[model samples]
Target: LYGLLRRNFRIEEIQLVRPDINLLQKDDGTWNLPITSSDNGAGSSKEAMMLPFIADNVQIIDGNLTWAKVGETTSLSIQNFTIRLKIHSINSFPNMDLNLSVGEMDSTMISPIKDIKANLKTSEGLASLDNLSLNISGGSIEMKGDSTLPSKDKDAEYTATISVKNIDLETLISQFVPEAKELLKGVVDADITIKGQGFDAKADIKFSIPSLLVQDKIKIEQVKGNINYADFDFIISDITMNVFGGNVVGKGTGTLANISNPEFNLAFNVNNIDTGIALTALGQDALLAQGKLSGNINASGNISDIKADGKISSDKLNIKKMGDLTDITAPFRATITKQDKEVNIDNFSAKIYGGSVEGKANIIFGKDGQPHFSTTLNLSGLEAGNALKQLAGKAFLTGKTEGNIQLAGQGTDINTLTGSTDIIFKNGKLATHPIQNLLSVFIPALKTINFVAAKFLSTIGDGKVNITTATLENPQLLMYYGKGQMKLSNQKLAIPSHLLMRCDMVAKMPLVSGAFVREDENWCGIDFNILGTLSNPKSDLGDKLKGQAIGSAIEQIFGGDKDKEDKGGGGIGDLLEGIFK
Candidate 1:
């Protein structure tokens, strides 16, 4: 009968169960049964021979049977005919009152079961399976009350309440992402419970499938966890996950739709989590830093669309062969939303370096599974020079540099960032090191000016520059454009004595402090324009004694009866070329 039923009904599995019904009789002689299985099978050989069994009147109330196809079962011949079965049940059971239904079923080798229900035994706590109704067309199976044992111990008493209302955890998840159910098959567990209006339940749900072939792409090992969802709250505890040796423990809750929005309060602490191994678990690359990081994150958000606020700090992050000993501590707040074909980040802000970076970003997936996104960052009061050195191991400037930048970008990929920024520098100085070669040769004689003072005011005059763009493209600036002024002071030019003799002029001597010095008091002032590129500037200095020399030379050339005239000091040439003429 077992082999005939396994072949006829297409039952692919079967198991024989031993009875575990212990009945206790009361002393009242009324046979008050604590628990009992009423025997309806053949009582004895003599009684079985006396009564002719009628098949129409006899029906097995609570029963169980396991049926499975053996080896070499081809798809064409592996239909309902290939299933082999063996029956198992409490031989006899007394049902005072009974109501049962098939809750779910596993998928068949060929057809998918959309919905299923089975009769349950609630009398002796043995939970005998009665009948099963399955929808084998779609890949959805739902079994009712005590269909599958909590553990491999078949005789264990089942005491869990079962209530399911519109429950399709896998189906719901598949709607959002068809592969989500497959990805989370072993990565996550969905424990569902429905409790309201004087009803409650608790169930241990497991999605921890070791060696779970995800979409037949990658094989994961030691992925296991348990979830408890009941009474308007859900929690997952004692979660020991595996990814090159790591663990995660937390509790989460929300409405019971796998892909639907669910708010969850989570807390997790990681230990020795190999970033490379962890990222590989999620199908991503791991960029390692200086030291290992260990911290706990407290976040609350929905499953599909979540709002998380947490803080993660590191001792020192190593960016491989670069400078180290850098510490970053930041608090981030962000809201994640999911659309029909994409995910979005709204109001994402984090305090990084010395400034607050705020922005909104999004990732849109096309039909071909390609993701594109755009992000705009508003960074205020950032110390750019210091940040650049920390992130890239090179400084953009050296001396007291500080600024604010407003940047924006859009791209399909996150690696190759494309953006524009408007940066403003105040009292910022590019230290005199990188550009020392270019600037040192210009003022070779002016050795005292070791540092260029780009200030609001100068000792010569008011000095300032409005640098439109200070871009550093390695050894060259893409565009250098600015305007500034270099003022000249009212100081006398100390010319060499050899250059003075070429003038052929003289001036009256002015006696002061017991020393006589040539004085040209009328021609003491000279002015010049200072403007141009940093490499060169416009300037000119005129000789002050030229006027006196011209007058003296003409008189000497036209002399006929020149009187003994003291035109101020001695002869025409002498007077004209005196210290003061």
Candidate 2:
């Protein structure tokens, strides 16, 4: 039968190969059975002898069967007849929807397997790949497992590009400043992008850095032009933000040149900034000093070309803190130099009482930052008596006065003030409402004084002020050294007579120097020491007393006691005796 089998069948096709089956004892009392294929097969001899076995259901199948252990040429030996399956190459497996598992069939097959990486494709039209070439040094996922194709242009409505960073910023900063936990109490959250057309702008902002304990120190580096909403094309970089309590406002702009070195260009214009609220927010005593400062304030400037103009007006400015008028207006214009930090007043004027004064002053800051001022002022229709009464009380001024004055001064402080000006008093009308008027009736010669007084009043009272000149020194002495002359009643009294007889005469006040005196709309005199600011002093006591003829001699001798004697004869005697005593 063996000889016949070899001759009747193709010996190569009929050859049977079997693996070497081994059973080894392990240290744990377990057994390891390793089944491996034999290198040499029983070609003719084995086939010839197994012919009878082949006839009894041990026939060779149609196709070839090749099998081996993953790393070894081991034919698995199991319960009955050993069967072999052959696969040409791993590429034969399609990379499609296929579910497969690989594992050892028995407990003895404990040899470890190397990683089996594969691409999957299936007959049902799905494909996937794991490309190992494009991986970063660190662990990263590099795979494409898309089940769908790219959308066509006609079917796409939006396109999005996203970039995500897995690094933690706060964790990184913590290494430098361990106390950052107490410093920065918040995280950074910002969304910035550059979209398609009309979305070219970009904005970056940071807020509430708890590590620094800064509520909101925001900085927007840049934003595209398309996002400028309010009809303004703002090109800014390094723009810092301001945060007060909870309110946030954008303040400074950065320099476009260097991204790190930023510049600030902020201009805030608040038409009505609630100063009361601002003061309260500053933790100040919240009492309304001035009702409400409701006006426009515009501050616009750059570090290089900074120019600011602000005008503040209130409905009624309070002098509560100052202890003065309850209501008044103070409007001023200020111009400051950015380079030098010097401030100059182009115009600063206010209307107080019934008068208006306009002035222009400049403040020159010294090396120590002290301010010196050179100011010029023009006052119109100022009521001198009213102003004096308001300033020093009603007891200081004896009569009402209407005049205009001009002043110029330059000083660093109030104590060292120096200035000069001319004051003109017009339409002088003496209201004969005082005690001195009763003495005018003594002598007939006094009638001349009366007529002269009346004439001076008539010319000045209902008319323009009769002041010919009233000059003041550098440091004005209101009543002392100021001096001037008057053409009284179209008559030239001796300069002395004119000055002594006239009710309103320009003269230096009695005690003070450099100040002028205008007495009762009739007489004026200058200080005898410093010649008058305008001219020499003048007086006319001789003509004044001579004109009151009849009792002039006796009046002169007894004029001092005459008033006392007239009060009451015995009273006058008692007054004289008391004086003698």
TM-score for predicted model 2 compared with the true structure: 0.36
What tens digits encode model 1's per-residue C-alpha lDDT throughout 495-546? 1111111011111211111121222432221222223333232222112332
Instruction: Give candidate 2's whole-model lDDT.
Output: 0.32
lDDT of 2 by residue, 195-242 (tens): 222223233322222222221222222211111111122333222322
Whole-model lDDT values for every prediction:
0.37, 0.32
Model 1 residue runs over 4 Å out of place are 1-179, 187-200, 204-226, 229-233, 240-247, 254-265, 270-307, 318-325, 334-397, 410-435, 442-467, 471-581
On TM-score, the candidate that comes out on top is 1
Model 2 residue 571 CA deviation in Å: 6.7
